[model samples]
Target: MNELKISILGTGDMGGAIATALSRRTRHSLRLRGAQPGSTSALRLIDALGVTEASKEDFLASDIVFVVVPAASIEEAAAFLNGYQGIVVAVSVSGSVGRDGLPSSAERIATALPEATVVSAFTSIWSNVIREPGTSGKTSVFVSSDDDNAKEVVSRLATELGFEPINGGALSMALYAEVMGMFAVRLAMDSGYGRTISFHAFNAG
Candidate 1:
């Protein structure tokens, strides 16, 4: 497992969890920066992970870029990364549906940053579920992207993080995956399954 250079752009719940997960893996060189770089939470995460503040170049230089911010900040994240040419995995659901009724975070991000190969991934799986990607666990990480190459790239990253990444195929399917992600969270909330639950694909074969 050669070291993969990765950078996380945010220190919110999702971002912090992701940085912690990556830090626990010795095969990664992780750098992180927060939208509010000097905030209490960001500083705490930085200190805890021993990750220095990242620069614009650091964010862009990584083999993968994780947009692990809150759901509300998806559009803003896209706007901030408008011109970046890289593979971006949206780890947040980015809200249920836009007023137009077909707004997925991945799609909105693509619309905002046309140059980037944006992929909707890790959005369905909660941070808690990933923190301990259990051995012999059935949990899975779903990924959607128009570019097959980018999709494969993210899938490998997911594997490194101890997740079984399922290729949902074509960016259009991201809507359904997003819906599934929302449904999973709501199910956990209502069914008492808690945040640690993640979906697994059982082969019918």
Candidate 2:
């Protein structure tokens, strides 16, 4: 299989964690970019992960781009990817998108990057959880994308990286995942449930 060239925009906690995880697994090339110039946090993350530093332009050359950034800056991220024709994925840990019958951040990003396949995943689970071994069994990573091929590729990567993939379906369905992230994070913190909580479906007979 051809090595996957993945680019991660915003080397914050989530982005850094993902880069470190991928670095230990695939022979793929991973690039981690800072949201701004001279960001020490990002630099530290890139160094720790042994990944290369990248610019917004580098995203155009990547096979997959993950935005582990804040929602407030998503518009800027989308604008940068507006020129990219690759797969663009958003990783929102704040659960920024809501399901109040409105367009989701994933939808907004897809619209911005019309030439690219946009997806939202890797949000429901905390970055710390990914650091633990064998935690994948109790974790579910929800993924939503309008493009089938893009979703499948992301699913495969998630699996290879030791995550249980949950196809939440079309990009619009990301609203639900985003909301669920809110509950999950809150519960993890307040209820002292740790970072291993996940959604499980059962037959309601």
TM-scores for all predictions: 0.90, 0.89
Which runs in model 2 stand beyond 4 Å of their true positions? 93-96, 99-102, 133-138, 200-205
lDDT against true structure, model 1:
0.78
Listed per model in order, the count of residue pairs whose N, CA or C atoms clash below 3 Å is 0, 0
Worst 10 residues of 1 by lDDT: 91-100
In model 2, which range of ten residues has the least summed lDDT? Answer: 93-102
lDDT of 2 by residue, 89-166 (tens): 878644445635556667767777789888888777777866653643456788898889899999888878877788
lDDT of 1 by residue, 117-201 (tens): 8888877787787677766575777889989988987888788888888988888888878777777787889988888777888
Q: Please list all clashing residue pairs in model 2, or write none if there are none.
A: none
lDDT of each: 0.78, 0.78
Against the true structure, candidate 2 reaches a TM-score of 0.89
Evaluated against the true structure, the overall lDDT of model 2 is 0.78
